[model samples]
Target: MDTHEAAGCAEGASRRSVLAAGALGAGALGMGALGIGALGGCAANDAGPAPAAGAAVGGHAPGDAPGRGRVLGPADAIPVGGGQVFVAEQVVVTRPAADTYHAFTAVCTHAGCLVANVSNGTINCACHGSSFDATTGGVVNPPAPAPLREVTVTVTDGQLVLA
Candidate 1:
């Protein structure tokens, strides 16, 4: 080829390479922006009322009430190594031992629906079959990726009260 034509062809190839690099850079930037948005969305939230053990399907914390809550005593109310659903307060209080108790929301974190059942040591949300560990409130399964909301529980005079 002629020297002039060869130089022109090299310039065209260089220009195309720069454009391709720019496109890749733009795509990477877009992905990074999306990742940032997702991180912000999941940043800690203190945005709402605390859920309770027996509040309802959608449990709310004792703080939601103007007056303090009425605590219920143990004394065989909760079966040993079993849980009791307080539908009124939307709380599930379980007694793993005579002195050890665990409390979490009765509602499924996925859809805000009442957990259908607690069986085999896991709380089951039938709405989507999402399961939360009854004692720890950890997600045992997906579809409901977030762990079940936990409540601060206090035992006063054998009565379990949300603190």
Candidate 2:
């Protein structure tokens, strides 16, 4: 082949190589960005303890009475030996005895997911499969390293009130 033609072929091959390298670099960067995004989502899920145990779970502290102490519902909404999760209030109220009741924050200590359900005397968190005792808020299953935060509650005028 002519020298000019050979030089042209070499130049075209070099251009193709450079473009391929650039595309590979861009693909690697995109994958790295995706990995970072996934990690960021996980980190957000594990941010911190939901709310303090002693107070209302969302935004009210224990003594933020005027703002936080809304009547949850009738005391009987919680069955004897079982509990009810109030997602709005972020509290779980359990009646372990005939006239006794207990309240705890619904936030899971492991990954900050709300405790989803109460069954068979246990409060279950769906996110990471953590279980807590309905009566005492103690951890029953692991992935959660701590007990749920306890909240003081009282029955007033047949309604459950956060204290």
Candidate 3:
């Protein structure tokens, strides 16, 4: 073959290799991003302590109060001085004192993990050992940089509903 033709072929091969390398690099970056997102949602540093014995775990019951927003369950399901985690709804309802209730998002501020349970006057996240005050939703421990976000709740006909 002519030298010019050989040189052209060599250049084409070099371009193809460069393009392939770029594609592989892009794929790796995409996979890394996906892995980080999955970890944020799924990683729990430890399951942490099991819910304190007989701690409240609220669930919806039939004929609960029908309202303008989501029904969390009967208000009585939340133990006084403790709370219940509504995992599917991403909420926590606490009855810190009789006849009073508070609510907050279950998502942890540290890494987007869900808060696992409530006990000892604090809401707890298993992912990073962060805790928040059950009554005020204030941060009580770290690795968490912020408190859980408060969610408004109301009791209607003895059922707790999102407000």
Candidate 4:
């Protein structure tokens, strides 16, 4: 109603707008910093070329390098037409036939639980009754949206090693 009161109100509104702008600017700066930090983590490394998105490389994602060349056990431990679950290493190794071996992450695709065992020609997960094909790691039961992730493995000197 009065000029002084109106001026005071206008000043207050201007101050609020300035404060809001400052907060927005700070938020933008923080997001930029976070983006730069993420890109910095993707700098070149000695792990060789990166794999495609969602691709499984030895049970690891791109830029994730671990357990390389680590021996799981004697190749003979994996029986024909069945597999062995290495719980500690989080890998399920299968021998579809005597001279062939395949490896997959024991971690279930639906949930993060580790697979319990391999039986009846399938890799069994006790957590949710999910099972994957022993030879191909394909899903054989529900609750698992995807197949078990394939992990590269090699036979060296009678030992099964992660490649």
lDDT of 3 by residue, 39-83 (tens): 222322233222221222223221122233888789998989888
Model 3 has a clash total of 0
By TM-score rank, best first, the candidates go 3, 2, 4, 1
Which candidate leads in TM-score?
Answer: 3
Clashes per candidate (backbone, < 3 Å): 14, 0, 0, 0
Q: Write the per-residue lDDT of candidate 2 for residues 16-60, one digit (tens) a residue.
A: 433455466667684454332222101112332333333343455
Off by over 4 Å in 3: 1-26, 29-37, 41-68
Candidate number that wins on TM-score, 1 or 3: 3
**How much is the lDDT of residue 8 in candidate 2?**
22
Q: Where's the lowest-lDDT run of ten residues in candidate 1?
A: 38-47
Alpha-carbon RMSD of each model? 18.5, 16.9, 17.2, 16.5
Q: What is the lDDT of residue 131 in candidate 2?
A: 91
lDDT score for candidate 3 against the true structure? 0.63
**TM-score, one value per model:** 0.55, 0.62, 0.65, 0.60
Would you list the C-alpha lDDT of every candidate in the order shown?
0.55, 0.64, 0.63, 0.63
Displacement of residue 143 (Cα, Å) in model 3 is: 0.9
- For residues 63-149, write the lDDT of model 1, one tens digit per residue: 132213558556368776777766556567777778877877665566454555566787775545678787898999867768776
- In candidate 4, how many Å is residue 109 off? 0.6
